[model samples]
Target: MDLKKILWDFFFLLFETGSHSAGSLLRQSPQPRHTLHAGPRLSASASSKELLMKLRRNTGYSFVNCKKALETCGGDLKQAEIWLHKQAQKEGWSKAAKLQGRKTKEGLIGLLQEGNTTVLVEVNCETDFVSRNLKFQQLVQQVALGTMMYCQSLKDQLSTYSKGFLNSSELSGLPAGPDRDGSLKDQLALAIGKLGENMTLKRAAWVKVPSGFYVGSYVHGAMQSPSLHNLVLGKYGALVICETSEQKTNLEDIGRRLGQHVVGMAPLSVGSLDDEPGGEAETKMLSQPYLLDPSITLGQYVQPQGVSVVDFVRFECGEGEEAAETE
Candidate 1:
């Protein structure tokens, strides 16, 4: 009745039957390969290669550059990314400087508006073919929208518009989110590298209206269907600001009409010969014959409407560059 004796007798009976052997059972039994630490160490070279690939994918840098960055950072992914960015900044600025004096006669004007705030941006590339590129167009939109968003968030900084709305340095600092590697300048650099040509954020303007004022805009020669969202991807556009005594339901219509008129006439300013400062009589918006009704002057046409034109900005692509070249 003892347990050990009972098991021994049962095994002895099985061996006698000869259905299985102890040697065969021992051969089939599992055994430990080795100690955990005795296993192979991960390949450092493979890990470094993986980090290199990740850097290339995320930063859009050349494979050679990514590998060099990994090596420089001792295969640390985060440090490699930072090093790559520093290199990008250095290389981007160098590339920009080299292309600065090159004539950029072909590009698009991007515009965006939210509530009382609006922005206009001119982004230039070396060729018209590049201008039509979807990536380039998206860059223009991103820069415009990012700038508008930044300006709206910081009202006190809005005063900087007195000099100019944005400069290259300010644009380079804009937060462009993760897709653009955290800044507009980086996005631009990526574009330049991919397109193998020059790109410039030539100029930008921001307009914000006070209560009782309305801003309307129009675009001409858009590469795509002209809509409020993509209006800025056009050859020419105008932003017109109008002042009204009280908010009227018709103010938007009036502003839009004025915008269209400005786009057609390419007006220098909003006043007649008497009000304009030392300029040709025909250069003023109000002095020109109305676009809708050529028989009447613009001033005469708008006078009966009881609304006043406060300001206007008309942008024709390459106009400034043309003027500069002429001068």
Candidate 2:
């Protein structure tokens, strides 16, 4: 055998004999040591636990629920939220269903206007506290903005530019979601699950005026300042579209005043008592005394200004419930 082979054989023989020299050499060489105590593994585990805690805080779900949701979604935050919402709906639906009969007398009216187009939305919650929540306000704003933009885009395709109401089915068809991958209904469901309360997009309306007309909006009980043409009314809101015969007139100012009038008067229509639809006592907008004067009728107040009311929408929180109870 070669010298190297002989050396290797001698080394093994010494190792088998438990020679001190061979054992010392073997000890000198690096060998991986197995440890029962965790070091890096513990750190990794701690990071995961921290992440789980963070998700629980954000979602308002319990630790075990959050952990299970994260695991089910492969640690994806967005998917985990979706999963949690699904679970909430499955588990909480029976309880939530019982709440359907409960009156949602608290809510905020969100208004958005872009050019001659304006959108109004009423989102109702079970309590006033939820109405004041920033998240709920944001949801209202998003829904109003989305509705305004969507309606404006559809102006040419649809014959009428005004829709007085949007049912749940219609709302479900509107574009919504973080990626616009879903509808407003989906977002509402997610919010309902997260908030642990009953919520509804009670109503929505959109109005688009012609070039000679202008749309303005007013919000009462606003928690924040208005942005652009949008208004975040804390509880009540109004939208008014005014048409001017002369292009030189300041239509924006007139529209704003009209909107304020609508908000104050809670007008139902723009015509006189003769023109009233004769359904509800409060539906006669033109017959209502002028909010500013309280002497002249609203129709008379506007007739002298060379401006005509094109459309108007007034939304008061819990108004529907009041109407329902009366009926």
Candidate 3:
């Protein structure tokens, strides 16, 4: 049918339906009450406000982006959320690529212990401010947990006396997220997008406590994680492996104190007083003065209690390769 005829017929049918007579239409004002636009203006309608707020609350996205997603998905909240995640992932990778070469000298050291094995991970970013962010902290914690799981998966290939280290490239491919179904690189990319910083998973270390020994851990400048359990974030962290002749003693407490000493004193190697001579002993874990009791060397303090230090791992944020060699 012709356009004009179709419009006329539509109007005729409307009049015939008797909402308003043709004479009544003529009696209406000459101009329309609402101004007409060439196209629909993007807006949050009253009916969609509830949906918009729900989407914002659930996704933690900005109001403007949530509104756009809702509009793009025709106000279907589920579809809108999925759309937002996809867009964020897409934008995250793009941002990560652009910022890949920027220096990341500030971040957190994450510590996690599972059974006899302990894991420490250093995840770096562009600034200390991002280090304190909850999302960034969560990412670091998840990476540490993933590092533990990754090391555990390789247990059969390693010896009891062995220590495992995973560099940046190897860490990027591991599983991350709460369920650990997502790639670590993708998780990091999402964080880089949201936090607007270049980040890298610099390194991870795994150590297993041998039979009759325990691993003790501590974090300097430590704070309890807001989301994850048994995970701590800090500027410096340490894990100490200890062997004790007295099995009835409080070994955990001793191990923790040793860890604190390691974090605070920054020991270079796990040397005994017999092995390190003169000034060299100052940098050895056992020969140095214990941080909590400076009058006593760590060896002097623990030996009477039948505890002997075996091995340790210490991580400081933004430390160079020279410092990493101590691990």
Candidate 4:
């Protein structure tokens, strides 16, 4: 045999005898070569676990992202994080909008009441900033008013739009402006598409009330900015609905008390599923923290409470499902 060939064979034999080696050399030689993809070159010496940890620390992004960046960067941790950031700026954000789903614990609610006919709507967004946007607030306002008029299942409702959103497609019924047209649904999608992330409608509710005495709205945690139009529904709405009835005068006082109760209580279902004929005030006896969540109970209180809450609805925006609908 030639000297080079002999030496190569001998080295393989020597390598195979080593205790601390993986059989990687033999594996590489046996695999087909054309399967390689054309992408940025990555240094093969980097450890994936260490590189993943580095990318995660550098970017407050997802763990999947760090892994993907490493794969794209050929296991080079540094280049991978940079490339991942760039990728987020490009096509990855919409998919990588995992951050958008965090607690919206902040949002705007819309309530519409005309005469005795009353409606309450809650629209949730991912952050307080977007929740306070002019267009978004307008959309929620229009939606609440729309629900007042078009109380139908959302399955067939056309998407909605404001005066200046990006929707130039004929598919959306909007008129063509420099940046507008399409169905209302298209318009909402346009918002998500333009925002480079996820945008949602949380939940929507429609309520109607007759002769009770109180019908006012209050929004908590809403910014005082004129640009933001978030109005909180529910507690304020429940109070309004409760007051509009022609119940006893004591009932109206009880209604106000219930409003205060709702603001503080945040009961889950309007009442307990076990609430039966003898149901006293479900919130009467509880201490302070019971009403802070939908779960748990304040039970009942005595003092011969005179008012009874009629029907009420609670919809926690984005709490139970994914986006309201898929397009």
Which prediction has the highest TM-score against the true structure?
3
Superposed Cα deviation of residue 172, candidate 3 (Å): 0.9
* 81-183 per-residue lDDT for model 3 (tens digits): 8888778888889999999889999999888877777888999999988898988987898898788777777645433445667889888999884564478
| Per-model CA lDDT versus the true structure | 0.71, 0.69, 0.80, 0.46
lDDT of 2 by residue, 1-327 (tens): 699999999999878788877687787744434244566788879987987988887777789899999889988888897788678656555455656777777988877766766777778888998877766776687678668767767736433335456754676567773444466766676566656678777777777766666666777776662333345565777777666768745666766677778777666556643553332255567667667776666777777788767667677877853211100
User: Residue 131 of candidate 2: its Cα lDDT?
Assistant: 79
RMSD of candidates 1 onward, in order: 12.1, 10.8, 8.6, 16.9
- On the 0 to 100 scale, the lDDT of residue 66 in model 2 is 94
For TM-score, candidate 3 versus 4, the one ahead is: 3
TM-score of 2: 0.69
lDDT of the structure predicted as candidate 4: 0.46
- Candidate 1 residue-wise lDDT, 254-279, digit = tens: 77778788878777667643453322
Candidate 4, poorest ten consecutive residues by summed lDDT: 161-170
Better of 1 and 4 by TM-score: 1
Error in Å for residue 128 of model 1: 0.8
Kindly state the number of residue pairs that clash in model 3.
0
